[model samples]
Target chain A: MDETIEGSFQIIGGNFANAGEASMQLKSKLVELGIDEAIIRRAAIATFEAEMNVIIYAAAGRLQYYITPHEVTIKIDDMGPGIENIELAMQEGYSTAPDWVREMGWGAGMGLPNMKKNSDEFKIDSVVGEGTTVKMIIHFS
Target chain B: MKLSSIVESISLEVKTGKNNLQNDVTGVYISDLLSDVMANSKEGNIWITLQTHLNIVAVAGLKNLSGIIIVGNRQIQQDVLQKAESEKITVMSTPLPAFEVAGKLYQLLNG
Candidate 1:
């Protein structure tokens, strides 16, 4: 395969109604492009987790996707109160989400870990007062 | 077994997406957390949950799930029902708890 396709989506924080819309659209595009079903599922799940993070934690964010013959790359940057402890955040069952957020059946403290589990490669960086940025890559064979 | 069969066997109420009742269900995942379902649920699995959000339909679509069975007869908002219908994902309901529905589904699929 020889191709380059790139897309970007903006996510508003606290937008519960459209939380996972970006991931759903990305999954549909992958399906239309005939990506492997397994790969698509993995990428879709990862994307959804990242998208939810933006909605639950950030003020606003943007998710960018770049697809090539070899891999799909997702870069998400959000403006919000960043994580104080990256290591603790990566641990499952550690969440800072408020009660209202959890009431929506999310904020299970699984978002970042779940994204890492689904992606072939995952990296996250955050500044306590600034924001967070995540880089995830999923390779296709 | 077909999702419709599961509905018939369990006497589930078809809230919407009835057209997709013939879809095959290969497995079942019981969860209310969206991320848990996203990370672990497999394609063609019948997701049993109490979530009545539109995002559930979106997750079911992205995961290619067979259908969603809302337990406890929780009222799904109109938008969620519409989204499930448009996604062509079967949405059903049961007054029983998630465990009871899961047990019934497991027996039907395994026995």
Candidate 2:
């Protein structure tokens, strides 16, 4: 509670079999830290969405989390084709995922929106032909 | 209602986490889409879906859902069941589609 808890998880892109593993681990860690139930749920949801994005689009990525007494911060950095239009990608029901991804009940274009909704602070940056980075912070009051 | 009651009432096949059948089911949310469930489902709600992938278990665990009902009698892979068992998330299967499963759950929980 007094000291900051920090950890990082490796994410393998295009690996549907293990897509949500990172988020699951993060959730377990948060639970172990005795964070509020509501806050842990929000943090887990946000982290899961971010993890899915990395797997569905990027080649690989790393998810890092820092939990302090004040806030929980999640950072995801991936290597793959970056979002060409952040605004368009942010729109609800707008997605560029392929047909195969759609059939799996994913690519709903709701990932980013869900992350933002669950986090008190959300930021995303991307470079075309490069990769993307997403940062989300949830405050504990 | 307890998950065991629903499982027996509807003849749902317990795939894994049989020990967790006593979990309380607060509500029902039917969606094949993972994000939709994550965004809307409440804790202790039993998720009804046709999805039988590994990520489904993760979603159920992350949301603290009471259990998952795989509708349409979809064939769930071994790894998914293994993960569900490890996470202690009860997963059941039904021959009926999502619509029928949802209807029956609604009646059981409300009627």
Per residue, candidate 2 scores C-alpha lDDT tens digits across A1-141 of 789889898889888898778788888988887889999999999999999999999999999999888898999999989999999788655677775796687875678988999999999999999899999999987
Residue A134 lDDT in candidate 2: 94
Off by over 4 Å in 2: B1-111
**Candidate 2 C-alpha lDDT tens digits along B1-111:** 888999999999999999988888899998877878889999999999876657889999999999999887566767778999999999998889989888887888888
DockQ of candidate 2 relative to the true structure: 0.07
TM-score of chain B of each: 0.95, 0.97
Candidate 1 C-alpha lDDT tens digits along B1-111: 888888898999998888888898899999987888999999999999977656788999999999999888676667778888888888998899999998887788877
**What is the alpha-carbon lDDT for the whole of candidate 1?**
0.87
DockQ (C-alpha) of model 1? 0.07
RMSD of each: 14.2, 14.4
Window of ten residues with lowest summed lDDT in model 1 chain B: B72-81
Enumerate the candidates' DockQ scores in order.
0.07, 0.07
C-alpha lDDT score of every prediction, in listed order:
0.87, 0.87
